[model samples]
Target: MSNSSNVTKQFSAFYLENRLYGIEVGRVQEVVRSMLMTPIPLAPDYVCGLINLRGQVATAIGLRQLFGFHSEIPQDLINIVCKVDGMLISFQVDEIGDVIEVSESEFEPTPQTISEDIRKFMQGVYKVSNSLMSAIDVDNIIKFLNNKLK
Candidate 1:
């Protein structure tokens, strides 16, 4: 067995519907407060809008809608900026949390109980304190969405 499984990895945490979600820290460019977005006409429901960060533009994806959430969109949404397929994309989440470190040994396969909508995008889960953090695979999501749009 390889010792690489024992390595510790850090994740940027966020919340949606009171459930914890995370993404590998290295993949995250930065998290920022909501910015003004230019709405895209005829776009899917999950596409919130396009945001201009400094001089760069990023497509903001509503994680809530993407995850099939039905709750009212919160007043203050956070953006998790990431580079996917050489393009900067922003994932809009409900709230932001601290950076969390968990050993690779702590990683577990996605629970069989998770809904398929969410399970498809989750790489796995890590048990942290009293909660389990589902790791989001941003690239996987983008690829799926791209194929979906094609």
Candidate 2:
């Protein structure tokens, strides 16, 4: 094992829209329950769509739809705040899992050329023990939704 891998064995993987997505333990800023969303009629369906976060309006993007999968929403829905394009945005998640530290070498590069929408949503793949967490770039997600709506 390399020096970095010697210090850790797991990392936190978050459950969003039914997919297991993980980030470095240091990336997450905060976790909040699913905020009440305001319907933006003109917005695309993938938008899921918008919510008023405190005094600022934050758009909630449906990761499931973006990935071309059925949504997991019905009961458990949560908003996970992370830096997307340097701006804090709320992501609709099913539940937030515990933090896990893992080997840095476990990360695998995403295929540059994904042939489908589902594959496009995945930024990269990071393995956690026996589980696979798809690391998504929230920034690209926002851009994709925005462009689709427009």
Candidate 3:
């Protein structure tokens, strides 16, 4: 019998505050270079601004802020466009990493040692070589954003 734990999943990885993070490749629409953004007035601090993506406006979310990182956003950024709840959203990242394939056997639950701010949105983590790549929970992210807006 084939072991499910041997199955591998692909993730589109990125960096924020020097930590590695990944989102399921299936939900990722595209990764793009930084583009001009129009700041939204009175929007939550995490909602950095809006981007013009091929004439479609996408909300640009500063992952650092969303994750409660108290650091200034870098001038150079990468946009990881993802399809969440049928809406196109752009996540502003500090740097972009390659697509990673990790086996299910490497997965582990988020540790209690992690801070609540960052841990809340983590689906889990995958042991990668010498490091752990935290998995971002896209659904929780959208739900949190929705709640913030309401």
- Model 3, TM vs. native: 0.96
Off by over 4 Å in 3: none
Model 2 worst lDDT run, 10 consecutive residues: 4-13
What TM-score quantifies how close candidate 2 is to the native fold? 0.75
Give each model a TM-score.
Answer: 0.96, 0.75, 0.96
| Predicted candidate 1 versus true structure: per-residue lDDT over 1-150, tens digit per residue | 779767999999999999999999999998999999999998899999999999999999999999999999998899999987678899999999999999988899999999999999999999999889999988789987898766
Residue by residue across 26-127, what tens digits does model 2's lDDT show?
555677787777887876666776667666666776665566666455565777666555666666666788777655677677756643675566667767
lDDT of 1 at 93: 95
Model 1 residue 46 distance off true place after TM-score fit, in angstroms: 0.4
Better of 2 and 3 by TM-score: 3
Output candidate 3 Cα RMSD. 1.1
Which candidate wins on lDDT?
1
